[model samples]
Target: MNQRRQKKLSHHLFEAILTGDARSTKALLHRGASPERRNGDGTTPLYLASVQGEAEIARLLMEAGASPDIESSGPGSDGTPLCAAACWGHTETVRQLLAHGADPNLREDQGTGRTPLEWADGGPHPDTAEVLRAAGAQPSPHRAVGAM
Candidate 1:
């Protein structure tokens, strides 16, 4: 596909993710919308899907090769997809992200920010915290950023 078409598909893909439209997301991705493409908010399709708790969309993005651990760029609560899901108490989304290799212990902002566990723990979500803890997430928040 041409760059123009790819760009359009990517744009539409973001809309589909935001709306939790799994069918559209899947079609767009099948037509070559990049799972790795970030929106104007600097969030990938998977990240947005996680924030929206769209587990089916997230799974599609992952199957399309979205990096589960990639951080968001736009100024927002979202850092990693895992962080987005955890903070929102999206247990299934968190589980999907972890299964797809998202780093449960990874802090946002290159490690200086909160880990998924911390995000979960701080939120009104004990179940999310439990998921992270089961995944081996750490409780301490002072890890060196960019040390990964």
Candidate 2:
């Protein structure tokens, strides 16, 4: 029950998510591991899955009760799991998160003053921008950098 041991277990679970190892993830959860636990950067297993565009991983995390809307708790908390997926043009990931109740219009990290729409704009991928807009992301006056 030491802190270091718990963190090690969490990190193992986190790695399983990134590798899309559903079986291991399931086993970890079944053993009462915490999927919602965050990393040093406040990145949860869901966040890693979204960023990696691993649909199975994302699904597993969601089913385990990880909050799709948990912002980074870091500066701005601007990084929603959906936004991170969108920023990477992970259409399926974005769709999954939205279906699971992630707010497309979730506010961006503070000071950055951006939205998922803005994040999409900052990327070079047109498909991502389109997907975000289609998901009801709007054009705020904030105008994310490099948005077309």
Candidate 3:
């Protein structure tokens, strides 16, 4: 397929994942949309799914060959799918990513070098933090100014 068409499909897939519509997401993927393709804002389908706690979508993306650790583009693009999941307190998404080989120690590109653990720590998800720690995530020495 042409790059333009593929990108369009990817964008649609991104939206489907964001809205937790696994059916459309699956249809898009089956139609040649790349699970790893980044959206206009540099986020991937898996990242958006993770951020929204769409565990089933995340699993489908991973099973379709999406990298658990794919980084976003542009400035401050250090956010991995794992980071997005952790930041949003998506425990099941985090578990799925980790099971898919996501790096627990990944830090945000523009943040205070906070790992998934740090992000989870500041969020309302202590269980997420425990998952990160169990997966070998370590806290960054300097927390973000607003980090809890």
Candidate 4:
């Protein structure tokens, strides 16, 4: 596909992910849209899906070769899919990412510097915190408050 078309598909895939539109996301991926394509701030489709707690969409992107540990490039984009899911209290999404080999100990952006477990603990999701703990995730030393 041409660069223009691919760019369009990339944007569409991002939108589909944001809206939790699994069908559109699948179609875009089928058409060769990269699951790892990023927005201006370097957010991938998988990351967005995790943030939105769209497990099915995340699964589709992962199946299409989305890297669970792919960190964004821009400033404040140092978060992985697992980090996003954990921060948002998305237990199922966190589970899915973890099953797909997401790094439970991965830290977020510089300011936060929090691991998935720390994010979960800081949030209102005990279930997600338990999941992270079960995955062997530890909190960053700097943000150790409320860590499980």
| Per-model TM against the reference | 0.91, 0.80, 0.85, 0.89
Residue 4 CA displacement from its true place in model 2, Å: 6.3
Give the candidate number with the greatest lDDT.
1
Superposed by TM-score, candidate 1 places the C-alpha of residue 108 at a distance from the truth, in angstroms, of 0.7
- Clash pairs, candidate 1, are none
Better of 1 and 4 by TM-score: 1
Best by TM-score: 1
Computed on alpha carbons, the lDDT of every model, listed in order, comes to 0.85, 0.75, 0.82, 0.84
Per-residue lDDT of model 1, residues 1-148, tens digit only: 7988888999999889878899999888888899998777776778789989998999999999999999888767358899999988999999999999998888788867778877787776999898888989877845443332
User: Candidate 1: what lDDT?
Assistant: 0.85
Q: Considering lDDT, where higher is better, how would the candidates rank from best to worst? A: 1, 4, 3, 2
Q: What TM-score number comes out for model 4?
A: 0.89
Candidate 4 residue-wise lDDT, 1-148, digit = tens: 8988889999989888878899999999999999987887877888889888999998999999998988766455457788889888999999889888988887766435667887788886899999999999875666555644
lDDT of 3 by residue, 34-145 (tens): 9888877776777778878899999999999999877765344447778878888999999999999999987666444567887788775799999999999876766652
In model 3, which regions exceed 4 Å deviation? 74-78, 110-112, 141-148
lDDT of 2 by residue, 1-148 (tens): 6788778879889889878888888888777667688877777778778888876778777887888888665342237788778778887888788778888788746435456666666775577778777778777765536653
Give the deviation of candidate 3 from the true structure as CA RMSD.
2.7
Candidate 2: residue pairs that collide: 76-109, 76-110, 78-108, 78-109
Q: Which 10 consecutive positions of candidate 4 have the poorest summed lDDT? A: 139-148
